[model samples]
Every structure is written in structure tokens, then in C-alpha cells.
Target: MAKATRWRNFTRSEAFSGYVLVSPTAIYAVLLLAAPLATIVAFSFFKDGYLTVIREFTLQNYVDTWSDPVFRAILLRSLFVSGMVTLTTVLIAFPIAYYISFNVSRSMKSRWLFLITIPFWTSYLIRVFLWKVILGYNGVINSTLDIVGLIDQPLNMLNNVQAIVVTLAHAYAPFAILPIFVALEKIDRALLEAGQDLGESRLMTFWRVTLPLAMPGVVAAVLIVFIPTIGDYVTPQLIGGGKVPMVANLIQARMLDLDNKPMGSAIAVSAMAIVTLVSLLFLFLNRRFLRVQK
Candidate 1:
């Protein structure tokens, strides 16, 4: 039959093979990513009983989350901290990325990149703890200052927002750098030569030509640093000394400590929503830059 033959032909096709190749990843995504998200979304709408999540649908969880002053302040603080980290990371990363892309020889570039990743050789937790040691009351800076007779008292460096920002900015610096470096590397050097030939100064040429071509990488770096830093629990907990808890810490407290799954789910959902919107905005900017690059 014609229909039977058509079905048989399709099964033998490359398109079918492509689908077969992709099916495992697709299945994994659905099971792990989509299912967890759906479960959280369902839990966020349910009511919280003493130690149990009531199946009854309610919007009160969201209402309570949004209405709480503490939650609002913490959420705003998370945003501010992430924005500051993103700004700081990108500003610092650009020069390093630029130096690697423009100044370093191709043979030496790999060595430079390897050195940049040297921090990742240690466990992330160990790195954070090391920061705590350096920033604590009697830590490196204060001890050195005291030894040098610079100060009588050890400075209170930890347990503050500034400390959180510093720790996070350092941890996520490489994430920002790699993408911008990739972007800078993609730019054609001949374009720079052409700009100079057209009577443009190096600074002006960079501002007009190099920077625009590199915007996609910078945008990628922003999303990379911004998203994870906003939801970060470890740096805020370990470095900020529990005093400057972010949304992740609050969600952990609500979910585990309080045994209020529904409330925790609501807070988690709200945080996800905020992150989603910000991510989309940057993704839009990335697309615009891509089109311009084209």
C-alpha cells in the first residue's frame, strides 16, 4: 500500500535518525527540568498546613510572599547585589578579555586561558571558605594591618553586603571573562585596520567598531554572571555570615527549616519569575546585537 510504503520510507530517513539521536536529551529535559518546574508551580498554588502542603488551591501564598516587607527587602537586595556584581565583573573582565584577544599571540592565548581557569582547580566551597578566612575579624587584611601598625582594631570585614559582593564578584569573574573573550576573538582585525585607515583614532575605532561587534559576548557574560549570582546561597551564607541572606537562603529557610513547602515554593516561583524576565530582556538585547553583527 502507498501509505504503508511512505511510513516505511520515513523510518529509514535521516530526519528519523536525527529525531532518534535527539530523543534521549529531550526525554531527560522533560523528566528533570520540565517536571520539577511543573511540580513547583503546582506547589506554589497550594495551601500550607502545619507541616503539610494542603492540596487545596489558593493564591494566598503568593499574596503573603509579595506582602512581606522582609521578603521585599531581601529580594531587592538580591537584585542590587547581582546588578553590582554584573557591572563589576563585566568592567573588569573586558580589559582582560581585550588583552588576551588583541595583545596576546595565538600560541600564548591558550596558556593565558588556562591560567584564568586556575581558580576552578579548587572546590568552590573551599574557595569560599578561603575568602572567609581572608575577610574574618582577625583575617589576613586586619592581621597584616595590625602587624604593620596601621590599625589598633581588627576591621569587621565579614557579615556585610560589601563582603558578599566582593566574594561573588571574584567567584564569577571567569564566567564573565570567557564569553567576552570569545566575542572579542570573533572580531576581524582587518576591521580595526580599516577604521584606522579611515582617519579614526584607536580609541574611537574601538568605541565605534570593536565594542559593537563585541556586544554579544558582553551580553552573554551579563546573563551568565547575573542569573547565578542572584540565586546564590553559598557566597551570601558563607561570606555574608548569614546576616546578608539572599533569596536562595530565604527559600532554604522556608522550605527546610520552617517545613512550609507551599510558602517556599511561592518564593521560589517568584524568584524564578523575576529571573526569567531579566533573562529575557538580556536575551532580547543579545538578539539585537546579533542582528547588528550580521
Candidate 2:
């Protein structure tokens, strides 16, 4: 009876409730995320051959991955492409977010949000293919240009880095917009009024007050777009015509085509490290900016 009473009391406690609330997520992360990551890390230290992995430990995977010029070039290009996509997405998203948050009536906001999310209803691969059709030689753009007599031949728009960036930017626009809208909606209206009362113009008020308050959402949008884009194989493969290969494509080739799991794991680990470092740097800068604002 005493043990039962103590157990019941403990279960009723706030700390116990907190643990119960978080236990599901903790278990899910351990099972789904951490376990796979640990396996990949372990794989990175082993020797791999065609269709086989040796149990022997080696750092040669990492050494070879870094030393190869092709890998180095592809890694750098992947970072550049991801950065461009993030920038383009955020720039395009901000105006739409600002308008939706500030200009739209509350009753219509839901409808606006739904419209923004309409693209999600379609398959991602379908969207990529649609962009290919629009940009391809003798496709929509070229046909239109030809009809207008603007160009004598197809503009060579498809199968390039620019096409990949544009497609990715469009795909990630909704992700960027929602966070920024949330951030903008949370800003105190009184602050904007105060700025105006102090004789600031609308543009000045926005520059001094609105943009700073919205930085957190903008940062979130950047990370959301950048990380996955760096590892994206589909867009580059389909749009880049094998002319532009990102790190993820290289990893896939190593793992499947060459049957070298160790090299693929090493590349994946290195890419993760780079992304982690960049994310941490952005967070650190954001924190410092917040402190200075305070």
C-alpha cells in the first residue's frame, strides 16, 4: 500500500508529467533519427568494395573524399546552389507574407493560406516535371518565343544550374512564406504606430521596426530551404542533365553505382558537418543580433 501510494503521487507530480509528455518524442528521435545516424557514422569508418563492406576500420574513405578534385568541386557547387535557392525563396516569399499578414482581412486569411498551399496538393516530382516542360527546348518558353519571333532558336534554358535554382525556389516558397507570416503577425501593432508617431515614414518604420522583428522567421525559412536543397538529387539530376551534380548525387552514385557504402557514408557525414556548422553560425549571429536589439 505504501509503495502504491508513493508511485501514484510521483505520477501526479509536474516533473513526471513533463517526462510523460516528452517520452514519445524522445523515443521516436532515438529510434528513427539517432539510430540511423549512428549506423552511418559507423559505416563511414569501414572499408567498402564492390558489393561488399570489409569489417576493417579505415579513414581512407574520408581522405579520398576530401582529396578528389571532382568531389571538392561538386560539394562547393552544391553549397552555392543551395544558397542561391534559399535567397531566391526568401526574397519571393517576403512580399507575399507581408501582404497576407498585414493587408488581408482575418476572415479571408485562411483562404489565402489555402491558396498558398495549393502546390502541396500536387506531387513534388510532378511539379519538377512541369518546370521541365515549361523550360525545355521546343517547350512552352521556346514556343512562345518562337511565335513572337523573339529568338531564332530555343534559348537553351533547361538542363542548367539556373533552372534548378528556379524550380527549387518555387517549391520552397510556401515553406518560407508561412514562417514569415507567423513572425509578422506576432509583431505588436503599437510598435509600428509608435514609429509612425515619431515622424518615421512607412518605409522607415518598416526598415526600423518590422524587418528586425521578422528576422527569426526569415532565419527559419533560410535553414528550411538550404539544408534539404544541399542534399537534393532529384532537381539537379532531372534539370541539370548530368551536367551539374550535387553532393547528394555523388553520394548516391558512390553507394549504388560503385557499391561503396563507406565512401558514400563519409561524403554524407562531411555534408552533415558542413550544414551543422553553417546552421550553428546562423543561430549564433541571430542570438547576437537579438541581444543588440534588446
Candidate 3:
């Protein structure tokens, strides 16, 4: 009885110490994330426009935002762009991840990994702007095609959906690759050997063993790529040439240009809700995938 009491006391002391050690991080999170979220939620209910606060509750903002055609179009366009970007980044990154984890030698793998991530060392804005120059009317792409007699005139490549997708893909590809690579790296080599020993083909082993183990990374990459692309304002504005209006742009214009703070807040809230839903769905899928593998 004495020993049991001593162990219980020791466990309680350890738990208290652990909480004390983590208290700093908890306080930071409350300040940075929780506090701001609470502010946004509170602001959503207030009757405020620009510099004036009416201190009353109203649903007119949501009503007007939902009724606006332009806002709806921007929301839809944001979804489409984020979806395409996620799909393209994942599909392209998977093969590179597969090769790195399963095929390459150790020395070559390090070199190739360095090469893949080296693009990120450059300025992000400069990289996106380079695409702008390349796709412009007098850009290198058009000049090269003309020189090769493949085209008589420059193609209309700039300020379009294609430009936005290409730019975003380049920017987000590393995120997809890194997660999948981490998942692939965690897989045991012995599992593959055992599968082969049981007469499973390479493709069969990959489908059953490799892919299942790499699912956590896949889900992580999807969330990372999709979440940011959905809210990206700069890429669409710069490359989309004012033709495509994402949800972020619409919200910004509403708040800054039109002085419609209420509608802007509504749009912001709507976008946040969509993002929250997608993130939850991704988590569910990831949990399901993990369970199936088990």
C-alpha cells in the first residue's frame, strides 16, 4: 500500500512537470491562434462598416454576400483552382517520391533530393514572376516556338487559368514531394523483400505495401497544397491578369476598395468555413486510409 501510494505521487509530480514545461507553448498558441480566431468570431456578429461600429447584431452581411453573383463566382473559381493545383502537384510528385525511396542508391538519392528542393532557395516572388515573363507575348517560350517554326505568332499564355495553375504547381510541388518522401522513407525494406519472397510482383507490392504506408504523407501534402491555394491572392492577381478572381481577391476588394466590411467579413467567414470542412474531410480520409492499412 505504501509503494502504491509513492508511485501515484511520483506520477502526479511528473504530470505536473510536463504541463509546466508545455505551458509556454500553450500560452503562445492562445495568443497567436486562439485569440485571433475568437476575435474574428466576435467581429462576425457586429454591425460595423469601415470606421464606424453600430454595436448591434445583424445578418445582412451574410445575406448580401450570398446573393452577390460575383462573390459566388470568385468562391467557385477559388475551389476549382485549389482542386486542380492539389491534383497536379500530387500526381507529379508521387513518381519522383517513388523513385527516390525505392529505386535510387543512397548517394544518388541525396544528390537528387538536393536538386529537387534547390528551387525553393530562390525568391518565391521572383520564381512566379519568371513564369510571367516566359508566358508573355514576347516571352522566351513564344520566341523559341517561332524560331522552330512551330508557331507563326505568340500564343496567349499570360493572364489565364493555365498560367495560374502552372505557377502554383511549381510553388507547391516541393510540399507534396517532401511529405510523400517522408512516408516512403518510413517504409521498411524488409516488407518489400517479404512480399517478393511470397511471389508478389513489384507493382503488386507497391500497391499493397508501399502505397498504404505512404498515405499519411499523401494526406499531409494534399492539405498543405490545397489550403494555401484556396486562399492565394498574389498568384491569381499577377498571373491571372485580373481575369480570374479568387475568394481572397474578392474579400480584399470588398474591404479595401468598396468599404464593405460586413460583406468582406462574411466572405472571410465563408472561406474559413470551407477550409475547415476540407481539412476535416482530409483528416477523416487519412484516418480511414491508415485504418484500412492496419
Candidate 1, residues 1-294, lDDT tens digits: the string is 999999999999999999999999999999999999999999999999998889999999999999999899999999999999999999999999999999999999999999999999998899899999999998999999999999999999999988888888889899999999999999999999999999999998988799989998998899999999999999999998798999999999999999999999999999989998988987887788767655
Question: TM-score-based ranking, best first?
Answer: 1, 2, 3
Candidate 3 versus truth, CA RMSD in Å, comes to 3.7
Which residue pairs does candidate 3 place in steric collision?
none
lDDT of each: 0.93, 0.93, 0.87
Q: What TM-score does each of the candidates earn?
A: 0.94, 0.94, 0.88
RMSD of 2: 2.0
Local accuracy of candidate 2 as per-residue lDDT tens digits, 1-294: 999999999999999999999999999999999999999999999998668899789999999999999999999999999999999999999999999999999999999999999999999999999999999997899999999999998999977899999999999999999999999999999999999999999998997799889998999999999999999988999989878999999999999988889999999999999999988998899888877766
Give the poorly placed runs of model 1, Cα more than 4 Å off: 1-3, 283-294
